[model samples]
Target: MINLYPVLKPFLMAVEPEAAHRAALGLLKSGLAPRYRHDDAALRCEVFGHVFANPLGLAAGFDKDAEVIAPMLRMGFGFVEAGTVTPLAQEGNPAPRLFRDVKNKSIINRLGFPGRGLEYFVAQVSDFRVAQGAGAAADGMLGINIGINKETASAFEDYSRCLSALAPMADYIVVNVSSPNTPGLRDLQSENMLDALLAGLMAVLNSLDIPPVARPVLLLKVAPDLTSDQRAAVAQLALRHHIGGLVVSNTTVARPEMLAPHLREEAGGLSGALLKDHACAVLGDFYRLTDGRLPLIGVGGISSAEDAWQRIRAGASLVQVYTGLIYEGPALVPDILRGLTARVRAAGMAHISEAVGADIDLAAPRAEAAA
Candidate 1:
């Protein structure tokens, strides 16, 4: 498919960020979005028991309500994650919540987890599956990212509710505990609270009537601002609970020095090119702390092939993109896949999985100590 984002760039930039996002989604839902298909055997890898066509995936925020999964999959991503959907719909934060620093290729959004809630989200997914026939997700995997409502007194209730409602249709379920825009959401990452949260969620999963083979794997999304100690605690808790995987390093609260001064003070998590280094650093930390035992999905500031390769070598079995799509558009998926295919051949590796953690030595004293 031809890349039309270049022509659309000027117009998209002229509109407000949130408006531009809605326009983009409307285009996708209406089948106006361009589609690209590039599937290379070298790019295939197994993650969380499912074999993904490639390591690159669309991160959760883009399809916040599961509206456009099929269109995105047709655009060449190996997988697409939908929703940070809550049990109940929310309007999210006030307007002006999404801000763009075009110069730095970054965005700051405090748009909490706004969506049509679980019932609406589940209905959309079910319709997608039915339309695709029995082989839904055959082209690419589907992940559902679940989150809590703004006023929920009990986090477990919200999370478990979402899990029960969405897990049946998801290839995997991501428990999002790291969105900075949601009030007190980050606090759940604390060791004590996280321990309890994971335990309760696991219990709920075990109680589900789905057969063992069909049950979706559970993953946790964490913040990028974790201290070394906090990272260690999370790693241990994940191992203890037998969690399926971790979406390493969500958007950062810390603004890079290179970010535009005015954009720096925006009250939200920051993502884009400026976030690449720190997100990779956090991915490396989690890899070492977990001793590379857990699968990690690297995301944040990935707009090119080299960025994806760096995350793979740094210990991410898979990587995802959100902000990168805003800057690079539909062609980004094929571009990265082609680059990765080349990189894998140049490195003399048969498949992309061989390059995972190529940059880290799990036997190092620090890693051993962390473990």
Candidate 2:
């Protein structure tokens, strides 16, 4: 029997990018899958106060809104992060916003933080609450990716607004200041900028009658293009403010040498194969810097079981993927979980946490040195 997906993707890619995304969401919501579920086994674990069935999670920018939660949950990822939702729902950048360099198995996208606003998303969370028994909610980690608006003058207010709305609804909330697509967004990673943003947001989080960090984790996502000093600064900030967790990367603005012709000219952050080494390198560095004091959501260029395990071993207690799914489809989720379990067994570890930072030498904390 001919597999329908291979025949469909080419044609799908031929259509407008945003429209095809809608169609994919519809298929998932309608309970369609490219293959049958091979693993219904629960792979639960506790992390950041919530119980995650598996370390696998859908990365941000995949479901910029919670439009396909029920369907994505049915596919078996332990968690799904919806949105990078902003304060306002706006159409993203102009067309050709998404591109596939199939030869390199990489994708470049400038889908500027497009989202349906926090108010709309809170409603989404309520209407589509994943049963704590059979969904990302039940598994212990349903994240709402938080971000600022592309045109907003006060990015801090944008983040604060989203946090206030999502704190009660989300299992954990991620503060995204790392997407390269939004001009000046990644600049938030600067020490002064990050300090200001997190300080403002933290005030709001503390005031929440039910803060997300009341076992509600605040995760920070970042761009991969940071220098060693910048990475150290982020670690210091994360430690200083008690950031509950982190997503190691958003996407890369740097186009590596392996990129094919015209690949570099495209405007957007790059993900997939090209990002593998750099992403891992940064994770390793962060692991060394933090000394295992923080929880991290590893992301970028993970397309295989080995890739996921590498992040786990590097210090990420959890992992997320976006581009890999675009290229490989739904089957990728289970493959990651099964691979991770096998890797754990091979390492002769009884629990996944034992495998974290196994090879990375976590040096002393940066704060101690500064003091």
Candidate that would win on lDDT? 1
Q: For each predicted model, how many residue pairs clash, with residues at least 3 apart or on different chains?
A: 0, 5
lDDT score of residue 48 within candidate 1: 88
TM-score of every prediction relative to native: 0.97, 0.91
Candidate 1: lDDT over CA atoms?
0.90
Write model 1 residue lDDT over 184-249, tens digit each, in one string.
999999999999999999999989988888899999999999887899899999999999989987
Q: Write the per-residue lDDT of candidate 2 for residues 1-371, one digit (tens) a residue.
A: 12466767887678776787878888776756543233423345678888777878888877777877766666777788999899898888878688888888898888897778877888887777645545443333579988878788788888888888888778888998888878888888999989988887877888889834454678899888998789989999988988887888888999899987787788789899899888987887787777788888888899999999888887888888888887777768777877777877788777787877886765654444321
Instruction: Go through the candidates in order and give each one's C-alpha lDDT.
Output: 0.90, 0.79
In candidate 2, the residue pairs with backbone N, CA or C atoms under 3 Å apart (3 or more residues apart, or in different chains) clash, namely 43-53, 51-140, 132-138, 212-216, 213-216
Best by TM-score: 1
Per-residue lDDT of 206 in model 2:
83
